[model samples]
Target: MGALLILAPFVPWGEFLSASIKNPGKYQRQKVVIDNKPEYKAAAGKVVNVNDLQTFPPNSNWVISYPSSGDSTLDAADADTFTKYELIRLPAELGGDMKDASAFVAFNKVCVHLWCSPNYNPAEGHKQYECPCHGSAYRLPDGLATAGPAAIQPPPTNAMPILILTADNDGALNIEPPVWEVNRNGVLGMGRALYQDGKVNVYKEAG
Candidate 1:
């Protein structure tokens, strides 16, 4: 038999090798796209402003970059330990108002492929996410990678987790961690949700 075709995300390294080597034509391959939907209240999560993403709210589930360094051009490996952070909520305005459109940004803290951590490079046009290991690129605006070696095509499920956000009474915004991963069936794998008490919930984003 010939080699089997493998897709991405669900086509984990192990599965691809097995199918391609032993069981050719046993499994069909597909692609999964990262969902960069704006994290909002109910429908979809609102997007985080690029600037506001630098800071953290008073009280929320958002993970803040440790020892943040404002250097945008910083690479993933050189981003300093503090440059990477997870967010639960963000302020409507960086220091002014949410209407500025430059207040927040949304991105996956995880890699599109094996869920690895990505590196940031401002020199590459304010790059928010990139996998140094496989060259998978991700846009911070919505955690969507325009190009890279993720899967020849996008994953069937939300390759990149969606960061849904909401503002609290104190005008502070909060977001849940990612709770879904791609499965063998090319469908969204429900994981522990940030909003509820389930094993995996798609309502929240990941860390």
Candidate 2:
């Protein structure tokens, strides 16, 4: 018998965005993007400049790299993490479900296939992120699998892991720790276990 196909019903952008915002664990405030070798640093209360991403233009993306040396389970060489996020400004008339013209969305840098980092490919006005390892393509704005083996059979999850983000008036964005890992049927799995109320914990960004 063929494998069962699971599909998640249409999920509004607002609903997914809101759940992440309301339940995200604590985040350390810092300037996510900066200049120099490290290119990022920890700060008490720093606001990120969203305008810095404008250089990539709408439909394009900026790759954010950060260090992650504290984890002992990870390989010794795996000392950094990456996330690709895009900012798009579409006219209301052409907008699908994205309510805001300036929409921001992000996903794990690791490709579900071989864990290779996917690169943004804005071709013919369509925004997509394609994996270099096996030519798998994930649709932008939602991170759904669109092509290649990653979208077909033999893959665990077609959709990419989404990072929930919330921004402040100053344009600084904070990431919620709990990641929503989408499955083949569009269902979600917890990237990490969550803590209950009254048990204090610090959610640190891997990058």
Candidate 3:
């Protein structure tokens, strides 16, 4: 039995292995649409104005949808997991102002550790993204893991996926379409790595 168990890995599972090897491209990495306009939509298909976000109490956050799937019937509140993001308005001490893109940040709600959803805690001196499932905590603004298991993980998995925001001439905030290759604007479920200069680096799968 021991020998059979040891040799099991060497044996191909017939058609499954053969089909996978025959069509290697069938499992290519997910492709995202990069040409989607940067528009922010709130629950019930309401268009969120960037200026309104600025007026929100400091440290407040709202769930928004980005990179529309072009389905007008789909409610923003019902957006797919990957398209949902938590938009945070920084506090005054964290460089939050009523204007400028720096006042806000958006992070993927999916926790990289175990795919549990994290929530924003606005308690004074405790503003952070906290995972209720495992107590993994991420610091505010940058989404860096500061406590719990996520903190001990290596790069790419140590940080939460963040979105890049830009302001239009009319003061509406838009989300720059995400590029999964380099983790720019961040890949939905995957975490991000940072360079020494604090810029997001290309994602490398963990070994």
CA shift of 78, model 2, Å: 7.7
Cα lDDT tens digits, model 3, 19-67, are 3245554423221112213242232343445565433446776665555
> Distance from true position, residue 8, model 3, in Å?
25
Q: Which candidate number has the best TM-score?
A: 3
Weakest 10 consecutive residues of candidate 3 by summed lDDT? 4-13
lDDT of 2 by residue, 31-106 (tens): 3332122222231112334443443234544443222222312322342333232222222233422322235555
- State the displacement of the C-alpha of residue 183, model 1, in Å, after optimal TM-score superposition: 14
Rank all candidate structures by their TM-score, best first, as comma-separated numbers: 3, 2, 1
* Per-residue C-alpha lDDT of model 1 across residues 36-151, encoded as one tens digit per residue: 22332221222233234333221122223322232222322343321233442223322223523223343445554555565555443443455676666655444445565553
Model 2 spans > 4 angstroms off: 1-31, 34-56, 66-102, 153-156, 180-207
Instruction: For candidate 3, give the lDDT.
Output: 0.59
Cα lDDT for residue 9, candidate 2: 23
Evaluated against the true structure, the overall lDDT of model 2 is 0.43
Residue pair clashes in candidate 2: 6-185
